[model samples]
Target chain A: MWTWQHVLTTVFGSIIFPLIIGLAWGKLVEDNKSFGGVLAGFFIVGTVWLLNHGIGLMYEPQMGGNLPGPWSDMALAAFWGLFVADLLEGKKIELEPILSGILGGVLGGLLLFAMV
Target chain B: MNFRRILMGMCTGAFAGFGVFTIWPSSLARWNWLGGWLAAGIIITTGWLVNHYAGGLPNKEGGAWVDMALSIWLSALLGGTVVLDPVNGLIRGAYGIFHGANLGGAFLTIILQLIGATIAGYFLYAARRSDA
Candidate 1:
């Protein structure tokens, strides 16, 4: 049911790549602890990617992973970023946002099924 | 911060979580685990939040439904863990680990959800102790 391409893409493309981007973004958020864009992080990751590519509009994310054409899910990476932020800040794991994100994800997924 | 509150919360929520998924209408075609868990999560989490805010919430008054909130919170946590399965969100990281919505999978989901909620509770308390 899965090819080598699928295996490789799912592992590296889906998991590892997002993990790396998440770590970087997490570190950035940790530095700016007062920053309020965690929700927006999940919201506007694509625009950040566009800017990170030296589209010449914004400072690169703490580190870069906006590779063109890679199979990436910005929301997943952002969730990991939130996890890392909590860990780095030594704060309570932000359960509310995570639950909310899951709610959004499942609701969005179901809506797609409905549309079809 | 009675420690038993968390434990009691987990035990009750565990059943609530199991019960919510157990009665899910997967046979209905339109209602699958994703929809089931999403509805459950939304209802549980929202109910918990409302309980908090409604009970003199901004200032932390007496008899504010802490245990009930904990149960609801853990129930939502359980729901969150459920939808990550391959059958639902197809969350790649959870693919092999979570399996799908089968018997063995449901058992595993309960256990993992317990662990997840427990860890969250640990963090919540640890932060509280430090704050105090």
Candidate 2:
């Protein structure tokens, strides 16, 4: 709950985890097609939505994932974090970055689901 | 005149908020996370202890302390499930704003809604005053 572990994990998982995933997402489309970041973001959102509702896909600590607390915030932050990161880094907002972020966010969600 | 715009903005915001909420799930509110399950468990335990020690006498509410205890856990289940409340719609939309960098204008949408909602609230209050 409000334990130190929960608070620390919240920062780690919610902010740091998403930032890392978002950074990678930025690179996902830098080299390839420069299209559909919005669409990709939608998919990432969709995957997380599925994970949240899907019976067996939970990231429960008592279960396999051992996530300190509910990690859906991290899942959500993953898709949206890229844009925030780019803005802070002063990176120009272009079609490609958005496209990669969302597309990569989808990948991140799926990857986490598989691992959990 | 201006009222029309206010209504429009409110409608648009509600639409957008609900849209975000449609995707937002209560996974983050996991019953066990952040002591939610613990709260329920403690209440249930307290109920049991009361029943065992104090004879679980019925109260004015027509239910025993133990019966009330049973409700603590049963009702506690709502803490997490309650994410569906309309206010959570705003919460979900706030999360969606994280994508504003890529999509742009996310703030404007929320701002318009804020103004619209304020004006609407005023009218609601006004309606209660017959003299107005």
Candidate 3:
């Protein structure tokens, strides 16, 4: 049952989050060059979002069928992007990786709680 | 701040992301444990290889490409995690995008995730600093 609600959720989760995160991440990590990172990150995640939607429209599978949960997908994408930024800096910080996920999870959980 | 440190940060982030993806609700039941572990290993290895071979490259975009590679590998890992079949996996994926489509839900999710990353990144960065 794909309703308006579903569409709205999709638009944000798929499109908006990546855009905001890309911008924020770029700004926070890359400073001057975050503009490039933001653009690149947005394009990369946007492509995935489009692909996911396009596939869904083309093949309307069952609910909870093939999708990996949102948490996993976004986390992975962000991790990859951040990884590139970190690598460029040339300083390997061991504890910094999970910090983002944990913080993201807490923030996500709180938001979900508020919504629910 | 240097290339080595940044590479280390990327690797750490990738590993954490892999763990989050693999050892979660799905890990308990529907997901393939062995496959997930194997995939994580491969992603980590690829990160290491990239660092070793491309560490000193003058081009800045190389790092971005590495991030892109991580996304592809993650998509592959996620796609592979579809134990019930591709259609089901995709439908579930749709459900995610569907949720993300909304302003309230999407904004909340993004902000929270980023905040989480920031706090976590700071701590991790600090720990690494102390280690040095």
Best by TM-score: 3
Cα lDDT for residue A106, candidate 1: 39
Q: What order do you get sorting by DockQ, best first?
A: 3, 1, 2
Q: Best candidate per lDDT, number?
A: 3
lDDT of 1 by residue, A1-116 (tens): 33444333322322322333333433544565423124223323323323322132211121222211111122232234234334544545433333333333333223222221
**Which regions of candidate 2 fall more than 4 Å away from where they truly are?**
A31-116, B1-17, B24-132
Docking class of 1: incorrect
Reported per model, the fraction of native interface contacts reproduced equals 0.00, 0.00, 0.04
Model 3 misplaced regions, further than 4 Å: A1-116, B1-31, B47-107
* lDDT per residue (tens digit) for residues A24-106 in model 3: 54443355343443343334433343443323311122333343233334433345435533544464544332333243333
For residues B95-125, what per-residue lDDT tens digits would candidate 2 score against the true structure? Answer: 1112222212222222222233233333333
In candidate 3, what are the lDDT values of residues B100-129, reduced to their tens digit?
Answer: 322332344344334444444444445445
After TM-score superposition, what is the CA distance of residue B56 in candidate 3 from its true location, in Å?
A: 11
Q: Compute the lDDT of residue B27 as modeled in candidate 3.
A: 32
Candidate 1 matches the true fold with a TM-score of 0.27
Prediction-by-prediction clash tally? 0, 3, 44
